[model samples]
Target: MTGTASARRSASPFSRAGVLGIVLVGFAAFIALLYFISAGDTGDRGNTGAAHASATGLNGYAGLVRLLENEQFDVTLSRTPSGLETTDLLILTPPLYSDPEDIAQILEARDYLGPTMVILPKWSASGPPNNLPAETADKFKDGWVALGSANTLQWTSELPAPFALTQKIETLEDDEVPQWSGLDQSGEVPTKTIAYAEQSALHDPLITDQSGHILALSVLGEEDSEYYNNAHWTVFVVEPDLVNNYGLSRQENAAAAIALVQQAGYEGDYSAVTFDLTLNGFGGAENLLTLAFRPPFLAATLCLILAMLSIAWRAFLRFGPAAIGGPEIAFGKKQLVSNGAGLIVRARRFGLLAAPYADLSARRLASRLGLIKHDAEAIDAALAVRLPEEEPYSLRADRLREARSSTEILRAAQALRELEGKLAK
Candidate 1:
């Protein structure tokens, strides 16, 4: 039984079928879960209607729509020109690339039912913010009164970059009057500086005059007396990088911008926010397409996929059989002793001691019987007669009991040996 157990312990699996079976089962479960999460319309889709963008529903906007919603702004997601009507203040985030048609639509509304905010992101040749043409650049300078440059940071504040580049948020001079009233934790307040620029990236004057009304000034724009006057308009243009999700989440730039928008006195606060590329643009083509085509569905699908993959990897891949080594042995001294005795008996070395022992026995018996030449038979007979069971062999026993030195002992033993043979015959 012990040997059987040892053999089994030493045995390896005959084939990999068991391992293969486990792999298949795990893979099946993984695929099933992946399909399930990605299949049906997941709730991760965009919300619909007025309730959707009303802080109640997060329908639209880029770079954290929830931030606006939390502040009781009528934040909505809209991509159509018609959807622009939903908000008085439209804060276009960075990463926006404008076509002529899009620019035309923006210009049409610039005069009256204006967007309170227009934020241009850092443009890169290869990414979400596509590089703008000189025409578009001119429009940005004349229209928004904002500019772009590398992000800046300092020991005193948390801006995204380390050096000053473009104007992000600008603070008005102490003597300048506010262009509008804004809310604070203390309720309604009056001030040109709703918040300080995360870094001092803003140009000397933040407002400019292009088409009569006070517009934002570009960071790189030339200084003109007309743009510096206080009564025209109040603009806070943050460094583009300072207002992104990574930066805004940490600093007060995002919150401050929201406040500024409300102070500008727009009707509703709804916007369809997307990067020039959608959220999916950050990953694979599938994700980009999904975000572009069906953003809500894609969002849900992604969530499910990630969840399923994590669970499957943990539950299936982490499990396996432990390895075993060689067979073992138990101990036994009694069995070893018996085996050694058997080996000695089989060697038949007892004859080597018997001949010498017989001669010695004859000599010792002779001495005991006072017969120096006595043999074994003589001693046997004497003892038997004295013991009273063998009188007939007494005389023979007496003669055979004589033995002298070692040679004599051997001779006497041989004579007794012959007598015993004659008696047996």
Candidate 2:
């Protein structure tokens, strides 16, 4: 029975290990959640037939992005406002209904970076709303848009000063279609509706029709003006179909699109292309999730992970034994005294111990001093003669015998033991 209890005691009945395991597991799950939140860009980028770069819809420039990537130019689809502030050539494909001020803000930021291309919208495309039955919604493939009639952007004149957009969409006769040419490549615009921004002194025409209305043009100004003296230039694509997915099926159009991207994005030995998605509603604000994984904060994140690992290791493995427990029923003099003390405590009999403990100390001291008579006066006189500096044994024993609380009894008993020791010395 004793061996059984000792074996049981060896492995703690309390679940110190189990509780620690729970804590470590909880911490790991919390870190995993934080990582998931911060791991990727936020927004719904799924194809809903929008004209942004991420969409494969006919009006979208996704094919243009793919062509740039295939041509080895560094291409990025930016969903944050920060993407606008870069030296790389930025392509803006803002929706017709978007705020002109937002577009102005982007251009103002890029004044130092230099060069941007604004593609005005022409096609009014739409997809079936999801409120329809799921079975019907599933029938339509992703990014499929029903092409509506080409419409002119009415709000283009509301842009920043010195820019006024008077755009026209003309449909030429069957045998009268001539290609627009620039950038050493030429491509035919769709005859059903050919779009152009009316020529003005502010425009430097890069691509144009036979009549010479601007299909694509660079912003121009006086020699000393910032537009002319800035690090690069800005071009506007009046026609949406020139580089959109609708025109990409033709080899000539595809080649022309490639040349246009290179010409616009070119700066140094090598230049990259970036497509803006913020205006198309894919933008996300910078928050804790974004900051934690960047810069000085990234170092802090790694340190936090290391701390968690160290704590888990400490919890999983023991460096030293906690304690070595004794048997259920121990033997010998020490155990006997411990058992007696426990009984006295349980019965509230602390006062009963004082008198007996002092009596026992007196007997032991008398025996040690080689005294025959153990009367109170005799023993005290002997102690006085033997150790003059010590308090007499009779006084210490009387204090011990009268003590009611455990603290008083312990102090009185200690004095008697010290006197006995000094006399023997």
Candidate 3:
């Protein structure tokens, strides 16, 4: 049994199936750990509803995105606030329920970065209501409800200079469409009557209704206003309907929206156009791990990863072959006794074996003395008669039976061994 167990333990530790299973399990665990770490602290941002860049609903700007892409413009739907820090045109579409002060702060933060176009919210929309069945809701065509002036006014009143909208909605008459200020006329304009705005002193009205109320306005940067300064421009579109999905359904409306984007980029480059989604509550907050790998700490992160991989590689290459263990058990009865004693010592159970060993020693001493049918009391009497008077053998035998510790048991065992030697003589 000992030899077989030793051989099994000495066998190769590098079985192909075992190594493959360990590798697979380790890889799966690593992937799961990474996913758990990344998914831990993602903030509350739901990607749905109107004005969201990816939303395909009626009020979504997906149509505008497609149009820009078709025009060969590099359009990106920016989910994080950091994306606004670019030299491209940044378009912001805040929902009707959004706080105006928050919008103002975002604009102020991105003011000097590049040109921005703020599209005012016009519709309040949502998914089908809970009261409707899923099948019925899926077929529901009307999801957007137009917001009243009170709601629109509250949001507009919170914006900073050259960004507010008129409380009164100005409607364009049939056959009336706002034209780009410097661009020449081309085709029969779409008769889509939409809302327009009135501007402040800091704004230059670029597009106007027949009554001349500003439909679209341009706000130039302080440096851009001067002769040679190369600062980008900012634009404000009062009504979002003109460029949204419902508006862009007509070819003429699409043309007008494209012209607006071009106009915003007139000062510099129109190569890239980005729509902001941070304001709509998507990808607003970032985790600490993401920040660590971003800019200045990227080198440190790479070094850490490389160091870990190197350590793992070194450990893998360190194992050459299994070492041969010697014969399972040593020879001889003395060896067996030594092994038993060693086991008792390691187990710290000397006191437990003391009584049994003492009793067996007494029995053997009796048998050697030619005593027959000797009980423990008879053996004790015989030991008392034969042993020295000073150290009583019977008393020492009782002490061994009552021994409660390894030291006490060791002394009792030694006394028994001495008594046995005397009896053998």
Best by lDDT: 2
Q: lDDT (0-100) at residue 337 of candidate 1?
A: 64
Ranking by TM-score: 2, 3, 1
For candidate 3, lDDT tens digit of each residue in 1-425? 66765676557668655665686799777766654444342432333355767666667788899999999999997766677777688998888778878877767666567778887776656655668777876775543322333234467766766455564454445556544232332222233434566556667777665565566777643334531154346777765666778668867678778888888887436769999887776654444567768889899989987997787667565443544557678899998999998998899877779778877877877786568854666776665676536365567778898989878888888887887787777
Per-candidate clashes come to 22, 0, 0
Over 4 Å off in model 3, which ranges? 1-49, 126-152, 165-167, 172-193, 221-232, 266-270, 287-343, 347-359, 372-425
Q: Please write out the lDDT profile of model 1 over residues 33-140, one tens digit for every residue.
A: 554343332333332111112112111234446676666655554433344443355444323332434433443443344443444333222211237676775543
State every prediction's TM-score relative to the real structure.
0.27, 0.67, 0.60
Which residue segments of model 1 deviate by more than 4 Å?
1-63, 94-97, 123-238, 266-425
lDDT of 2 by residue, 1-425 (tens): 66765665567644666767777799778766665444334434465567888777789888889987888889898777778887788999988786777777776677678578888888878886658798988887777776777887766666674345677888887778757888777868754588899877777777887777688877765557766677366678887788898888778888877766666665233367788888887775654556878998999999987997788678557533354567787999999999988998999888998888788888888898888867778888887787777787888888998888889988998888887777677
Worst 10 residues of 2 by lDDT: 36-45
Per-candidate local distance difference test: 0.39, 0.76, 0.68
- Sorted on lDDT, best first, the list reads 2, 3, 1
Model 1: lDDT of residue 319: 44
What C-alpha lDDT, on a 0 to 100 scale, does residue 161 get in candidate 1?
18
Clashing pairs in 2: none
Instruction: Using TM-score, give the best candidate's number.
Output: 2
